[model samples]
Target chain A: MEGPKIYGELFGLPITQTLVNTWIIMAMILVVCAILTKNMQKRPGKAQVIAETIVTVMDGLVGQTMGKDKMKFAPWMLALIMFLAFANTSGIYGLRSPTADLNCTVGLALMTFFMTQFYGLKSKGLGGFLKGFLEPMPFLLPINIIGEFANPVSLSFRLFGNMLGGGIIMALLYSALAGLYFFPVLIPVPFHFYFDIFSGLLQSFIFTMLSMVFISGAMD
Target chain B: MEGLDFIKACSAIGAGIAMIAGVGPGIGQGFAAGKGAEAVGRQPEAQSDIVRTMLLGAAVAETTGIYGLIVALILLFANPFY
Candidate 1:
């Protein structure tokens, strides 16, 4: 709010920098795919190697999290992770992470929650889906419904908090040490790693894995 | 005295709201943890992988909680709302 102005249009939505950045990431991914696939490299160039590595790493992660039966979800997980990892570290070069915004993070969380519900229903079927709501108690259905509604609240805030925290701290720290460079960078290095790299990647993985779990659990 | 007291009350309310953010991540991270345990039970050979993935997911799951803390801190130290 202090940084960017949010305006509502015919769509009746507040468009912020995070939304713009989401589009930027999507466009970049598409462009990268076109370029990478345009020159099919078997031996591998720098870009190709990096792409492969990212995919392979995420694929391995999905395999571990969701099992071989659900390996198809790997691509989705990889894309989300790569986007988040890049976006989180965007601040390293004087940019902000989209996850730094409540709307952006909440939007993603809602998407995950929706996917969780939809796929859970899809895999488990309608009857199974309804049945899942009654798990461990027929009397707890109302509470479970409330729990389902709360998924996005939790998911969105988790990401938003960490990114915003890191951002605010870095800003405060950097300003406090305007005259000096060493301590600001050195001291905050761990912070950037933990908040941006570690937390960013971890959150992405968690989001993807949970989505899968929700689907499986719903269907089961 | 009334004005100062009111400000203090508002800040306290904001802090409480911020802490409420922790609730969401708590449930989410717990879900991730349970899944990780289940995964390990199924495939002990993949225990390392399971742990790595679970820890990774749990860490992500923990972000929202951090966010709530940030908001609470902002309320305390950098309350734009005030």
Candidate 2:
């Protein structure tokens, strides 16, 4: 429904609940990463094993999706998935998912869009990248440009729309069931499972996978 | 004013109309599911992979429906015109 509430302002900028929640997610991620990597041993500890497994899984995923040559992008993809997974599922903790905000989703999608363009330019020289729009026929250049621009729009709206829809439905359900004492307790659990947990993780995976595809497609 | 009531009534109708976009994803995902079933039937061994890919594609197909829901929700709860 409405955007996140504005808690206050910092200097000239308005600080919203979304921003606060995002900062919390970031700090949590930072603390976990630090703790997980604090001790490196010849014989891996449980934490190290978990950390290594995550890394290798992410590495394998990126390799499979974007090819081994694009493995350098694994760290960025990993961070994107981690942030999105947490942000999308924050509703479980009774916090509004930051991904429900257009600004957050758009910002993340723009990062992916920029990465695609940057890698494209690097792989193909500036002239070559520019010339790509003219491929097969120069008449198709405008269509190609529009297609490229559509990527970020669709990407941002896809994530934002899903999370916001979930939030709105959950809110409406709670209010609708507020009159029934037991309905409120019994009804929302399955809805929460489908909307918050399943859709949240699925959307996060889709977003990251699409980012990899777009970036790799551009570079190739 | 009469104008204010008129706008509110129109906004409600607009929200209802926006939800018609759900038709696209419904049809698309149904077709995807049918195809997924066919694939799984053809290769029973690859059921897991087929189902996984189908779910992924179905989620993407759901974007337009979600967009429609968003517009309807915004119109009802966060009308910018208001």
Candidate of highest lDDT: 2
Which residue window of length 10 is worst by lDDT in model 1 chain A? A1-10
- The CA lDDT of each predicted structure is 0.73, 0.93
Residue B47: error of model 1 in Å?
Answer: 9.2
Error of 1 at A94 (Å): 1.5
What ranges in model 2 sit over 4 Å off? none
lDDT, residue A49, model 1: 81
Q: By DockQ thresholds, what CAPRI class is model 1?
A: medium
Tens-place lDDT per residue, model 1, A72-150, is 7787777776677667766675666777877787777877787788888788789888888898889999999998887
Q: TM-score (0 to 1) of chain B, per candidate?
A: 0.86, 0.95
lDDT of 1 at A171: 77
lDDT of 2 by residue, A50-99 (tens): 99999999999999999999889999999999999889999898889999
* Residue pairs whose backbone atoms clash in candidate 2: none
- lDDT of candidate model 1 versus the reference: 0.73
lDDT accuracy of residue A78 in candidate 2: 98
